[model samples]
Target: MTEQLLPENVQTWAQAPLPTAPPEPTPAGRLTIASVPAGHPYVRGISGADDGVVRLRDPLPDPADPDRWWPPVVLDAAWITQNADVVDVVHVHFGAESLPPGRLAGALDALDAAGLPLVYTAHDLTNPQLADQAPHEADLDLLISRASAVITLTDGAADEIARRWDRTAVVIPHPAIVAEGATPPPGRATGAFTVGVHLRDIRPGIDAVGSVRTLLAGLTDLRAAGVAAAGRVVVNDRVRDSDALDAVAALLTDRPDCVLVRRPRVADPELEQEVADLDVALLPYRHGTHSGWVELCHDLGVPVVGPRVGYAHEQHPDEFTAFEPDDGVSLARAVLAALARGTRPGSGERAALVQRRALARVVQHRAIVRAHTDVYRTVVRRTGASA
Candidate 1:
């Protein structure tokens, strides 16, 4: 039978067979990463306690300007030409959003010319920044097809890659972001049910108004059913004049139960506190492949009511409740279910439990680092032998 043709943008070799070979020895010594926002919680948490096998750090383009760390120079063909020797291998966690497909292809060609291996963690199958996924899809196809090895956070995402691109990706769960030794928030006060939804500048995939409206309706139902004596839905967003923000402002005028916290932007500590204070947090994403936010909420001992759009529920089934996409009624029902379950356990026992869980999570992260290191070694070795 003749092989069917793929789209112009889809990687041609995605359907190719894998070579059988003995496993390569694990790569050792300082391994640096060129992750977008190298200091992001996800990247930083990968080291887990202090596993010296991976010396992961994002090389700053400008030492003084932290913002310059993004759109990482490692992805530049010219930069890779000069600096491929600086790092043993290039592992791309992110930073493809800003690069055009042509630029990314150039970077891949540079890596090939330099005889340097490339590893990509498929963090976002669909970029939430763009409503239209074509560009991102094309970019992902190119990267996945050319990558030395691919890694993903969830089985669902891995399956999608296999189905769409005919490539198998190693599945690794995202690491917990909460500090291993950090303290968990005190349990909720008696009779108070606090559910939070963050609407930050009305990001593309978030239906902020729809989420808020659902939560408000849910709160009303919970109070009427006597499941909650008192309820408060804390909605945090950057103060902006958008349809979502306007609707929130109008809702605040009519509803005394809702508290709208307006801030220009929430810092890491404050964001963590916002999730820590809630009985349950709602993630209002219309579409996403997975969520580090859900992992963080779990680490903080807060359950998440997330949309069924992606693998948020799979990330932590115990801590996540999924509602149908854009279905206000489903979300309302999920909220009520969370309220009926009551607040998380008290500080003493629960805090101790969380601390133990945090330690386990640290170990999990170390394993992830080790796994990536293994892949790096395999790719570098195979490429070297071929050379």
Candidate 2:
């Protein structure tokens, strides 16, 4: 079959040779998780900082370029070949983020060759709305047949995978990591309402040239509607070209407080603190479900003001004030209202009630690890392979 060409934004990479494996151990009960990128926010939320149920390993570094999810994921060849029995169950974390074609194929093929029981956790694959959906879906189906159990970030995502693959996914949305005893950042005297768009997933079609046009149009309507506020658009990699970014910068150059801070994933915690300092946060997303961005805001107790698309509603906390996607005007209104009448951390009664609600629906860390453990055990049982 001819290889499908990637979008202008995506690219390919060389496949690393599979890792060499040790002889099978009949007496061991270990499981190996094939994480695409270690320390990814999703992984961190799911694994909850590695508590003793399954061994996790990845070829990628802790802080790889967050925006560049395309290809060259840590030499997987060295991984599968070298660390075959590193775990009893071979749970491969697969998603539609981005990767080299041959690299993904090689990883699955190697696992098959090793006679390992495979489990795939689908994060965001099969969403045809994504730019590279065709290839992503093809790879997902190819990998699905080998899956012992499918884990997904949202119930909707799981259902979609099941419908496409004809197999059920164990629904396991990523958990929020509570920052215990941490105080919110100091409020800015003259704040710039922040809208954190981790611009990696944002396509060039909505650049400053285009997105700014949308925002400006929205702002005009918002000002007319008497609900406009001054704020900076916080970004990590919103623009693909420096010139495009410069144009975006120029749009804000006249504003006294408009700022752009190039933040690495490692620096995101501090960045979030800065974002929390703002009165309101915006997603301004065009498409897709299950946002790590929204969850981050909720965990930080930062109120969100985003479009009613994808998983942005997951952050609404209720039915009111959810803005429609791509509407700068409505989004601006949501932001203005939250900023103008500052949100109080729920009063003591509300806080306690919220905690109880959180506890009731809590996705415990142990539960997440145990879910993987069960998948491992099930895979081992099904494959009847020597551990």
Candidate 3:
């Protein structure tokens, strides 16, 4: 197939060799980064450091809906062209969900014309919101091909990026989402095995109902086989579809071992508590890329049972359980395996584990921040030399 030419104004490095290894640049004054949607947990976690290496600009509210911080102000070509004088670097994290290819290309052109480099953290290779991968792939084709530097969460993701785009990306670990000094919820009843399933505004990638049914079935099977004397599955969902909501409630109605909790929405505190409260958290995503939720679970010493999609298994083999996606039986067997391992620790031991995990997160997040700071400095230095 003949390669279609980009519009006259669009700039791309698709044919260029992989970027050369960058020399470590010396850090100086605070670098102002215009990170799209700076309020996201991942972005905030990485940038939340006392060391003044990077200062991120707060994302402007959405023009259409003033309550949200999406469709970031920096995404506008006019905004970038106007604000480029102040933004040292434009780092894109999560606000590319709506941009078409031509518009994304225009944003890149604006950044280039203004002499501002772009640093894109490839959070999602396949956008969770979209059912189709083509549009997202096209968007990445332009963005990844032109980004001055690209960052991703896992080595597996980086390898995939290299294979797909012929571009090299730095692998930076995801930072902790839970705040430091967070207290895990009070332990469950002694000798009780409990798992949590959260269906918060289900995404296209997730099969929430199927996953919940699988969990209930798995727990029921485990109990019947004497693998466990008693087991519980706690489900949390918000005020959404009335019928879907009723179905969940009805499924658990007769099953005394299973309980469904309906709330308006999951606030941050509740989210943290939910992680701490679960002996295990079940993830039902059949297809997707990476996860901040899994990291959050890890931060609180909660093990996750995610599907065998994306790099979740590769990200932390020992810490997570991967089951064949779309197979309720496979998911049931995986949960049973987790139960067969052993009972959760007592309060004293649990406290110690929580402390250890929390401390590890602190060190990991700081290191991640330093690594990103290095990347920013390197990109700025290279941009300066090229100009």
Q: Across residues 1-387, which tens digit of lDDT does each residue of candidate 3 receive?
A: 000111222223111122122223335566777777676666777875564555544544323433455445567677777666556788888756554346677888999898888999998898766667887888788779999999999999999999998989999987776776666554444456667777665556666666767777777766776655233333345323456556666778778776676565556766666556667778767578887778767666667787777887766667778776555567667776655442363455556767787888878878888889888888989898221
TM-score of 1: 0.84
TM-score of 2: 0.72
Q: RMSD for each model, in Å, please?
A: 8.9, 6.2, 8.6
Task: State, as a TM-score between 0 and 1, how close model 3 is to the true structure.
Answer: 0.84
lDDT of 2 by residue, 72-179 (tens): 343245556666655455555543335556666776677767776667777555342355557766777766765667777766676677677788888765665443
Q: Which residue pairs in candidate 3 have backbone atoms (N, alpha carbon, C) closer than 3 angstroms, thus clashing?
A: none
Best by lDDT: 3
Question: What tens-digit string does per-residue lDDT give for candidate 1 at 224-326?
Answer: 7665523344444542337767876776676767677776465666667667767778887877777777877777777778778667788988777777655
Error of 1 at 173 (Å): 0.6
